[model samples]
Target chain A: MTALPPPSAKKLGLVIDLDTCVGCHACVVSCKEWNSQSPLGAPLADLDAYGAAPEGTFLNRVHSFEVTREAGPPVVVHFPKSCLHCEDAPCVTVCPTGASYKRAEDGIVLVNEDICIGCGLCAWACPYGAREMDGAERVMKKCTLCVDRIYNETLPEPDRVPACVKSCPAGARHFGDLGDEDSAVSRLVAEREGFALMPDQGTKPVNRYLPPRPRDALPEFDVLAPYLEPVTEGAGGFLGWLDRTLGKI
Target chain B: MHPAPSLILFTVLSGLGFGLMVWLGFGALVPLGWVGFVFWALAYGLAGGGLLAATFHLGHPERAWRALSQWRTSWLSREGVLSIVTFAVMAPHAAGSVFLDRPLPVLGALGGGLALLTVFSTAMIYAQLRSVPRWHHWTTPAVFMLAALAGGGLLAGQVAAAGPLFALLAVALALHWHMGDRRFAAGPDTAESATGLGRIGKVRLLAPPHTGRNYLLREMVHVVGRKHAARLRLIALAAGAVVPAVLLVALPAGHLLGALAVLLHLAGMLAARWLFFAEAEHVVGLYYGRR
Candidate 1:
């Protein structure tokens, strides 16, 4: 079962727009909240909760980086990372126990906790650091793409998406069948020029991140100009004479 | 990358155990009756003890049996299966040597071959991990095999064979170290590619995903001081290969000296194994601005 099933035609994935994300951590909060209560996945473990050191397992995380461009001021990019649901997910193939597997139907990767020995090889195999070992349950946990919600007949159509996507205030997170070129998410990816993280790894991640748009440059200004401007423009002042002499020279 | 004690012991002890079995299977110093039983006991003790240590590293040891079911794809599973097969095939020979004072040459050779394959499978567990560039090279398995041969030779009291085997191990270890130091930097992975934001210029982690350390950082990101590591490498080489090889070739084979050599070799192997896990740099660390 660890051997990957043949590639599925319907590649369900997410596209995140970096230009709009505010690094609010709302998705992180909502993810923890929903997954803890949802019947689909096991509860995320938080050891030493309400204590000095609270370590827990989370399916998704947001990391912010300061990027300095050659032409503009440095900008901060907030990167939200989770299971990319790669076409050749290394985590699945490396699993000693067949607990980790990928769905043949939609290409979604998942972990069957019942058979997992928690050897932690799947986590080590992952280049993206997407898998986490639960502190209390001691089982491998990952972003299931909200398998329970994505196809639940009981939920409303709008609520079928993953919790993080549904709760994102900036609308940075978008999800749909990326295999379909005409799908809205696919079109959005094309328009924004979305890219895969660590393409060199060859996992062929299904998810994409839209790079930040170019910023409009502001006019150059000096803080001390006002104080120096009045003196320089004046009436027989030393600075005025100096400027005039330099101009004449 | 945390250099867990259980794993270090597992690899070192098992490597020595299986290595001795190879020489013994080939009919070297085939002690009969009680002596044979004692020799086999030591080999089984080290190998079985190391295997037990490895299980302690698992989160669910009770479910460890499931690991054997996925041998088709997983190296870890292959190691499990091979270990079982090697032990089973080697059983009759071990029993015959101890109980009947006889050497079952055919069964012994097959088990010995399987034992070597099992060691190779164990090494592949680390070698196959592309995520950790330091352990991804062919040299990784080569080093493991060299160490096993030399250690096994010494443990089996094959002094004639020990000199050359230890020499090869020393050379391989040095070459592996030289290659491993440059692997990550030479490879395509970098902080820029990891985040896919390098087109802008330089990308650095301005704010981390969380304030507290997570499992990834704890398990994968570990660094050892350059001076300390260098000192340990020299010590490992001297104690593991040079000294033992010297003692075997230059001095008379006496009980006290042989015991001392084995102990020194064990200490060296332990240091080397610890460095193996500690020095490995996982690519995931790039996201955290770490090596």
Candidate 2:
């Protein structure tokens, strides 16, 4: 007889405040550092480390976007993207080897690398592009929500949070058991108008982002342009000629 | 929807195996001589290789037998069952053709039906994956049918002994090719309405989440260059369908021309099969910043 999954525990989740994020990319680096040494092996891969085509680690990435409002200063939104640990989790059901699965306890989606045949189907099933294949291991890898740190008894109580949450300089990242009505994440969801990325697909992602506050007025682009350093120089003129010759302004 | 090489090989090879079986069975029913025996042998060889290729795609080959149980909900299961049946039928028919004085036409027809069913089932596997808007259509089955007809025509032309069979294969190939072209032209309905956004506005990707390549980008958002795809399509049409038809008409005069046509047709079919996977756009791709 098929065994039933254990009754799910309060879903642990995150609520990111986009308004406060500084786009420092500290979370990206910290996530890589934490997951790189985990039992599942490195979730991130570096290519051409010191060569011409230098590339960094994977796991999570911070994307910086400048959103222009009709009126006000341009808001720089730092979007940190990672596995949302969705409830529906198509990546789990689509796995031909049953290697990718969602934990019944906290709704954390994970991959059992040992059982993975590396067919790469689970990666296709995910709309979020959260999964990445580890070239060295020949298996799929992703964010594990710092499962080792969060559960380890030796770690200090405050440091048990996920690497990204722990390292957020602006206190933009929040982590808690979302299933509890009184949990910090649940309270934030009730008070703030948080939105899920691409919610139509209905993956029921646990992570939520607080939308940036509306701008009342537009920024003066012409005035700001002069103050900002010139990114590229003109083709001809004394300054341009000097820049061309020197390869710098 | 990204047609892996294993799947492409499986579908095309199986289609040829099944199509040849159908033609050979029909010939036997008409009381044709050695022509039927030649087709039966070819069918056995192709079907065997196709089945073996399919096994390589499985993650757990030991548990492959479990796949046969889920036919009620899985086209893949039905394909597995039908492929096995096709092989079981082909073995006896091949034995009779080689050793026995008389070939059983009725038994051959049964085996041929089973093989054809397997091909149709394989086509349905892609057609049923609702996540891929490109594959989830009637055109998918049309492509499978065309592949079989074109492959069968090429095989019939090579044998030379089956004159009427060659003519039928050519006609079927023409019909399938026409249908496939129409389907390929009618691309997926990936409008904003399909994505469930009621607002009327042009949505574009302002920023993607990650900098490095991810599985979704690599698998779902595959973009083949338009000019390259067009060139390949032309090659596939000429080599897979047109050349085989021309060879069928000229087979009586020159045997080498017929042989050359089969080789060209195989290459063309392989190209077409590659495009079939490469060109398909999954609905999940829309979520990953694809316009």
Residue B202 in model 1: shift from native, Å?
Answer: 0.7
Going through the candidates in the order shown, the clash numbers are 0, 4
Interface RMSD of each: 0.7, 5.9
Worst 10 residues of 1 chain B by lDDT: B218-227
- Candidate 1: tens digits of C-alpha lDDT, residues A1-249: 999999989999999999999999899988888888877667999988888988899999999999988886899999999999999999999999999999999999999998999889999999999999988888899998888889998999999999999999999999999888999999999998999988888899999999999888876987877777544455577867888899898
TM-score of each: 0.94, 0.70
- Chain A of candidate 2 gets a TM-score of 0.80
Residues A14-106 of candidate 2 have per-residue lDDT tens digits of 788877787888888899888887775645666666776555446776655544444445555666777888776756655545567778878
Where is the poorest 10-residue window by lDDT in model 1 chain A? A228-237
DockQ of each: 0.81, 0.11
**Residue pairs in clash, model 2:** A71-A217, A71-A218, A72-A217, A72-A218
Predicted structure 2, TM vs. truth: 0.70
